[model samples]
Target chain A: MNDTNYTPSVAYLGPEASFTHIAAAELFGHKGLTPRPTIPDCIEAVTEGHVAYAVVPLENALEGSVPLTIDYLFHGGELFITAEISTPIGQHLMVNKAQKDFTDQLESIQSHPHALAQCHKFLQYRYRKIPLIQTTSTAAAAKYISEQPALHIAAIGNQLAAETYGLHIVEENIHDFHFNHTRFVVLSLRKEILDHKNHAASKKTTLMVKLPEDDKAGMLHQILSVFSWRRLNLSKIESRPLKTGLGHYFFIIDVNESEDHPMMKGAMEELAALGCTARSFGSYYVYETDPSSE
Target chain B: MNDTNYTPSVAYLGPEASFTHIAAAELFGHKGLTPRPTIPDCIEAVTEGHVAYAVVPLENALEGSVPLTIDYLFHGGELFITAEISTPIGQHLMVNKAQKDFTDQLESIQSHPHALAQCHKFLQYRYRKIPLIQTTSTAAAAKYISEQPALHIAAIGNQLAAETYGLHIVEENIHDFHFNHTRFVVLSLRKEILDHKNHAASKKTTLMVKLPEDDKAGMLHQILSVFSWRRLNLSKIESRPLKTGLGHYFFIIDVNESEDHPMMKGAMEELAALGCTARSFGSYYVYETDPSSE
Candidate 1:
């Protein structure tokens, strides 16, 4: 499986035609792709040596971070992020081909909770009386709608789902905000991928830091002071529970520099001196989806 | 509707027996409690004057922040946090009474995604081949299992759900971790509740701040410096996208001081001087659920 002649297999969170699937396609092209039912399954596939790589959503511009992905990476196991991909999210109203007048025949809409929330204004204004059913994923909802023979049912999902499930797009771009985007990370058990020259050229490092048990006044500020004094730019900062009890959290920071950078190294050493444990996941380049390719 | 003789109505996110319902009951004690079908619906019920107060989950001990609640509070409307409640979460595996041997007869387990994830270890070890179905809520799953006459179906939910739906608890405490808890906030449009003596003595304030259009290095550090210099303790800090674009975000900080405190007032003024806009939600005491009362 480690031979260069072997076809590399990639896993993603999917029921097919999911946003994660689109991100995986953007990164791997038409190579061997496997769709896993959940985030954990996708990562497990990589850890268990069934796949060479796994792609999972890290955060969304509109909805914030994906909790499952972050929690698993922080506490569940040790998997390094090899690369990053950012894709623009476009949600559409999909229905069976027999449904012509959606407004008149639309009895209920089915979709993932996030998709329904993203199209809040459109749903409230048009189908105020109808109910909204929750599904595991937008792609799952599209598959369900395609399998049904009802005219009053529809789903809110991406264009890829409509195409894959043989549904017709009744309306396009129904999301409340036009600038929705999701960031996905490529995870792999192989350390060689992180040491690749192409990945090293991109100066971005993500670190997970856990502060001292005694959280005194100005403790967080002290940790931030290390990076502030060095003038290292931080692109994002998020906190997740340690799961020990209430009020216990660990911080994840994305810095605009590589792990080997002198400033980042100094900051990490200073943080360790201040009773903080910091671990660098990896340094990787982010690839933006090209509109022309889509 | 605002008369003294009127019995105020309260709303919670529910199809009944939800965690939000339990929080609402602990606060209102069965006084005019109404169950809203969704988080947005519960908030809208209060905003439209249909209900006097709404109870919604803010964060979980294991799952971190509830993105829907945070996003709605940040961008949806003008509701303010009047009070806070913390409830212990206890999950149970429930089955219909007719099913005596669930280990052999169980074909599917239905639950909300969070509930399913929390009970991952139990499900995987005991019934590896059973299909897990996703529902809108844990309470909804319990209701569905109760209504069906099939012995092959089961649900993972709270004890209240088991009792409410007349199901038998096959196993208790099925969650992966023991210390599971969720923080709920009481939202209201009325200002008189915040002026009460009990709420004024809590001395905890939550502030939402939006940085200037140009995000520069060390800007967040400067904002934290205002509180650090005064020796004010900070409980939590979270960032959410401003919906403007991919790189823009606004910060939400929880300070261990009242909004009217001189130190907090000075911090807000200094933050404003540094090109940031801050709004105080409120100061209130947190009530922990009493096991004996339940």
Candidate 2:
């Protein structure tokens, strides 16, 4: 399984045509892609040596962080984020081909809760009276709607889902915000590996830092001070519950520098000297989805 | 209603016996407590003058922040936090009275997905084969189980929910963790007010701060630098999607100081000078739940 010469397969959270499937295809091409039912399953597939890597949603622009992915990285096995992929999310109103002409008379709308919530404005303005059912995923909704062509049900999902399920796109880009995007991370047992065709556009080193138990005043500021003076640029800063109790949190800082950089190393060393436990989640290369290829 | 002198009824997010209901009852008396179907409904009840205030959960120790409450505060109508309530979360396994003696032979378990996820370990160990149903809330599950007397369905909810629905608790504190807590905020048109019997145990000022559009390097550090120099202790710092695009976020910072304090005021001014837009969400006094009273 550790054949560095030959990269095997990759697993993603999916039932085919889900966002993770799209991301996995974009990263590893259409070959040897396995769709796991859940995020945990995808991650376990990698750790259990079923696949060379796993791709899962890390965060969304409108919905914020994916807790399962973050929690897995924080508390689960020894997996590292080997690569980062950012893709623009385009949600469409898809219906079965049998009822394509009767788009206005939808019996019900279905999608993942987040997707339904994303298209909330459109749905409220148009299909306000129609019931919105929550499914396990966008693809699941699309599959259900496709399976029951007699039922006039619409699904809010990506274009791939409509194509995969033989559905027609009734409306395009129904999402409330045009700026919706989801960030996916490639998790691998080994670090600093990109088995895909795309080259690295940039680099980011994510560090999970926990301050000393006695949260003294300005402790977080001091932690920031370590990187502030060194001129390390931070792309994102997020705090997650330590799960111990209220008022306890650990910061996930994404620094715009490679882990091997002197400044990054010095900052981690300084954090330790200040009695903070800092772990480098990963130093991964950032890649953007090729719109032309899609 | 402009009747600041005369306190009116309050609205809370509830299907009866929910955590918000418990928090509302803890803050206000049992009288004049209206239960709204949703968080937005509760907030709207206050804004539309149906109620004087709305009590909604802001954050949970395990699940993190409640986006609906935060979004309403940031983007919705004019509202201010008048009071804050912190309550311990105790999840219990409850069954209908008819099946009280057959707890071990339960057919299914139902709860809000968050509640179900919280009690994942207990459910897996005891009744792994039981089908888990997702309800809108834990109280909803309790209500449903109570209504269906013939079904051997159990609900994992609070003690109040079990008592309210006349259900028997088969297991107490079934949640995997013991340090779970939820912070609920009392939203009102007027600020610095507490309409309850309990006095303020502590004070906190929450600020919603956004960095300039250019997002210069170390801009966040500069923002923190203002409070760092003043030695303002921050209880929590969370970043939410600005809903514009990726790599953009506005932070919700909870500082352990009154908004009127000079240090706090100076920090806002400094932030303003640093090309940051900062708004004081509220300067509310925090009240701890009286466990003995419950």
Candidate 3:
């Protein structure tokens, strides 16, 4: 019954160069891998058992939550976060070195929509309207642009993407915000590890719960009451609408203890009785602050 | 010497059919009006005095925050939420009536990238690879597909958009979430408003605050502590990167009171003294909960 007996394939949103894909690979760290083509495909793969695990992005500091990820979590079936990973955004102005006039010589700025968005001011100052087109992924934009002309077009992307497409970074760390970090969640057919060497890491469990139909008043208070009564330290609680029904919603809470912890187990039992769907996504101490090289 | 002596023209983020445009019309209902191309242009109009006010979408109930809107508030000169309005998601599957079996014979889905994302599952179940494409606006998509000979392509848009584009509503209320609401804030050339009527109709005051450079934990707790001290009810608090230097962040707080309300004004004064950037938008209370009728 141990994980050592399992060799389940892992699926993630990818083109082999997506930030999500990169985060997934890093989260898995050389485990069984099967990169899927789209976010939904990865969700479907995990739901169908085509793969034992899947990885997707939840939110970035710049952009709050990945609406799709929230939708996937709310819409029922597919997956749950087995573990969470925080990825840093150290984007740069990537371009093919063949073109000159690097400083203020941008005709068009290109990258994944999200990247283009995160560096909103830089583009506003430099190339507001030369046509900020889209690519399938940041890597795709860099690869496609580097192949032909990098004259006036520059792609703002991460260093990994710049390296993958063999492009030079014209300018480094162009993100308007230096504290940018994206929280990515790992989902698998199996459960994540909770026991850790450190005491601080011992009491952490992630859960997603669906609120009852109708009644929006005192929403958070009602959800918190369950945790407070159980003496569970409800460290974080966020709400995402249940994508299907009206007035129904999903509440994700980060508790300060393992499910195996005696008191926390009692809270989970009461929470389960509330008709709330809860999942244990490993218990480990997460970096309390955004870590950046800047 | 008074706002009563001057009535300012405002440009919003859309045409007649866009939600921002509708919000502009609603906020500036009888106020002076000017139309603009993009959100930034509207902000520019306000900043440069081309218009007196510019309305921008700050956040959604389902999606945490509009990243571009937040970024604009961070970079654009001297702007803050002058007023707030909440509009429910009026989602519809709009199609050219020429297409007879629209659902059974559908080939593609078109809408703004966000709208497309919001209705991801409905399309996934109904039409898997039916080529979900993005447009500048949902109205733009509706307009674009109106002239196309391909009868199978349809757009998911708002009711006003469908009516304006002369498209038929093949399906009503198609958004994945039921309680979908987008909250917009009006930005102005100047900080203060003209009259008490504006304040009387206002039920919320939205403010932007930057965490002081001090590295004390619970800076947010400190910010909220002020409101708690005054027994002020907070509607929501969205945390976003400050878009300035490293490790710095900004918080957008929506409080349940008009700007003129003593509780809110006192809190604003305290917040400013704590190195907060506060701007009070004119107050109007319009809480439309019905997603379809809106």
Candidate 4:
């Protein structure tokens, strides 16, 4: 929801140097905002009115869907997607200032496994058969390596993490894909951020729908048919099994338009008749691509 | 293709304690399998002609997509999906045998961040706000905590990891859902096994297509239109952006018909004319529901 009077301070799922922090930073970059730790904490902050808003990662270009983000949106109706931000995630081969040029051209390649996987080609082409140590975070890897200078290790991390941990950017953008971007959703109590920004007018809206436990396949068909019947476009749909094991499934949907339309209203109504939990992430916006570069 | 005469050795992503290992074990439960140490190794094993099939994760019940599996499928057409297996995943709270009981319950709760998030509810319900330590693997956490017994530290992992490391199950099924499954696909060099199991007449086939470096939306439409054009049932469609960067996307499609049909042949021809790479994974008998469980 748009709060014209206040600059929204959003909470993100984090531990100081998480990608969620990066997402929050990008979401609030134009507005100059700060982020709190943890997605649930972010949801709680929004619910308790500690901050004007919160931002969390709904999906990643490489990893696909994020379930906790979907689950929180499905369960917590207090916050809605005010805007969306997509940032190109070009990870790096960062090292502590102490580690110099490689003698073997390869030491230990330390990083979060996901980061390691994203830079799979680089590691394979360069190291081939060297040890790949998994760290909790890129920051954690950098942090640990900063203390163990003699260990001869290079950590794959973000630019910010390298700078923060006094590490040098030994190699830039080691990820397999140069155009990696993680998409984030800005959440707020107000459901109408679209009108204020004029920025989100052309943006997409994300909806989370919880499917009924009984006859799962049939229920999925009925819900999908609603979108089909209306000729409404769905950009993405991710099915996440509800963790409570109640046999219910949650579908995180990204549509090309807002929830204000008659067709969308009808779709939601039909969705409700199916006897399931359906909630909107309100008005969301995604980034325009830099065609020549990206 | 299936090789009915020869039992092939297989490579999968895992250490003995990994969920990947559990999936590999279950998928090859009836038949013996040799598990590889890593997914890259698995891919390499198949590429080097050491193994006929490699089992890799396509998607998780909680997470939407697994990109590397798709990347390998796209990069190497020499492999095809032979068997699809779904393995149940449930997080467990384990403690060293020496530390029989948690003193303060949780001076700390250790796990991979994913496991921590998956059992967020159980953690919040069980303990007060305590430090949650993230490790590379749940098994790593179990091994660490088991080797260094602490009163209030409990590790979250699988039963196998806990038992192997001489840890007791402090809490069972700590995952968010009961039906949590990671889908695994077996890639083979030839379609021999399926052909052996198939009758003289059979109906479905799996195909992998690498769309041109152009309009992604248009490609998805054309891919979908082919099945809709033939009135063929399109069951599953998954897309992975190719590693080569912008506009290049790889799609995996499952159709309820054989390639022998002229309509299907024409559709394949049309798809090929669009300047895309397509390869068939052959046709095989499949049960939507697990036959043994059913």
What TM-score would each prediction reach against the true structure? 0.91, 0.84, 0.74, 0.80
Q: Distance (Å) between predicted and true CA of A167, model 1?
A: 1.5
What lDDT tens digits, residue by residue, belong to model 4 across residues B42-128? 777887788877877776533213655565566666776666655677687877777775545567878766677778678777764
DockQ of 3: 0.18
Docking class of 2: acceptable
Q: Write the per-residue lDDT of candidate 1 for residues A232-269, one digit (tens) a residue.
A: 97777776778798778798888888788888888988
Clashing pairs in 3: A203-A256, A203-A257, A243-B176, B82-B281, B82-B282, B83-B281, B202-B283
lDDT of 1 by residue, B176-254 (tens): 7655567788899874343322222455778898989886988888888989999998888877777777778898888
RMSD of each: 3.5, 4.2, 5.9, 5.3
- How would you encode candidate 4's per-residue C-alpha lDDT over A1-294 as one tens digit per residue? 256576656676655556666656554543634444345656667878887777677665332235456666676667777777666776888766766665255567887767887787788888777788877666678788778877778888877677668887777877775655666777778876633332434767778887665643244455666776577766665555666652345767666776888888888888889887778777566653232322
Give the local distance difference test score of model 1.
0.78
Please state the error at residue B33 of candidate 4 in Å. 5.4
Better by TM-score, candidate 2 or 1: 1
lDDT score of model 4?
0.65
lDDT of 2 by residue, A1-294 (tens): 234466469997766898878777876777789886555667778987889889888875222226546765776648888988877788899999999998878889988655776676687688879988866568878999999989888998987898899999989888766655678989888876574555565678888999899878888888888988999988888777777766788888889898899988899999999999999877887777865443
Error in Å for residue A204 of model 2: 1.0
Clashes of 4: 11
Ranking of all candidate structures by their DockQ, best first = 1, 2, 4, 3
Candidates 1 onward: DockQ, in order: 0.47, 0.36, 0.18, 0.22
Predicted chain B of candidate 1, TM-score versus the true chain B: 0.89
Arrange candidates by TM-score, descending.
1, 2, 4, 3
